[model samples]
Target: MKKTLLTFAVVLAIASASNAQTKIPPNIEKLLQKNTCLACHKVDVKLIGPAYKDVAKKKYKPEQIVELIKKPVPSNWPGYIPMAALPNVPADEALTIAKWITTLK
Candidate 1:
């Protein structure tokens, strides 16, 4: 029982550490909230859509990200449900969010 508890504690600590590493900046957090982007995406963990970090791993430029936000391609992410295109998101706000997303990694 003691061994099991110790292992659990170690796993919890590692999870916390990883979560801590994905802190979102206040400005970006505001934009995400305002645009309802947080409903589907998170900085590190997957929600309804891919995590921002995972998107960053794709190395898409900010402009490309903005385009994706406005017109998402379902084929880009297999297995996950297709992201709805956010054509209503203002271009400037989308670009701001995109620029920040590209810096996640």
Candidate 2:
């Protein structure tokens, strides 16, 4: 528990420092937990949807990424299962999230 707390503390510190550029806010983690976003999309390996690492490989501008996240284009990824839109996710916050996800590598 102590180690967990310390690790979480370190993450919080780094996250806070990088808050302005991060798509997932501290509170968003709670929402994501409830929404189960991680079940399909992971940081590295591809699951049901393309991995965040793969999305980053496309090298989209922040705004373009924001648009993609807002309305996931099924045709763009026809062979794979189409991603559903996440309307609950606000544009500004999603933009931050996309930018941060793209920086995973």
Candidate 3:
């Protein structure tokens, strides 16, 4: 019983550590807040849309990401609802966010 409990605790700790969220840089965090991107996206976890880390996994170039922000493609993410186009986001800010997203694991 004692060995089983110890093994369970060890597995739980490993899982928790593996799933820990990555810390967002302050500058990027501010931009995300200002653009309201956090309303749907998170660094490591999926919210309304896919997680930034998942987006990073897609290996999209920063330019492509910026375009996606301005004009979302629903077909790219079948299950999730189409993202609203954020044409109002300044070009530079969008690029900044895209570059940061590409840096995610």
RMSD of 1: 2.3
Per-model lDDT: 0.91, 0.73, 0.94
Name every residue pair that clashes in candidate 1: none
Off by over 4 Å in 3: none
Candidates sorted by TM-score, descending order? 3, 1, 2
Clashing pairs in 3: none
Tell me the TM-score of each prediction against the true structure: 0.84, 0.63, 0.89
Model 2 TM: 0.63
Question: Best-fitting candidate, measured by lDDT?
Answer: 3
For each candidate, how many residue pairs have backbone atoms clashing (under 3 Å)? 0, 2, 0
lDDT of 2 by residue, 1-105 (tens): 999999999999997786445344566565445556677876556889887778888888888877876688888776789887877776767776767766766
Candidate order by lDDT, decreasing, is: 3, 1, 2
Tens-digit lDDT track of model 3 for 1-105: 999999999999998887774789899999999999999999888899999999999999999999999999999998999999999999999999999999988
lDDT of 3: 0.94
Candidate 2 residue runs with Cα over 4 Å from true position: 1-35
Residue ranges of candidate 1 with Cα displaced over 4 Å: 1-15
Pick by TM-score: 1 or 3, better one? 3
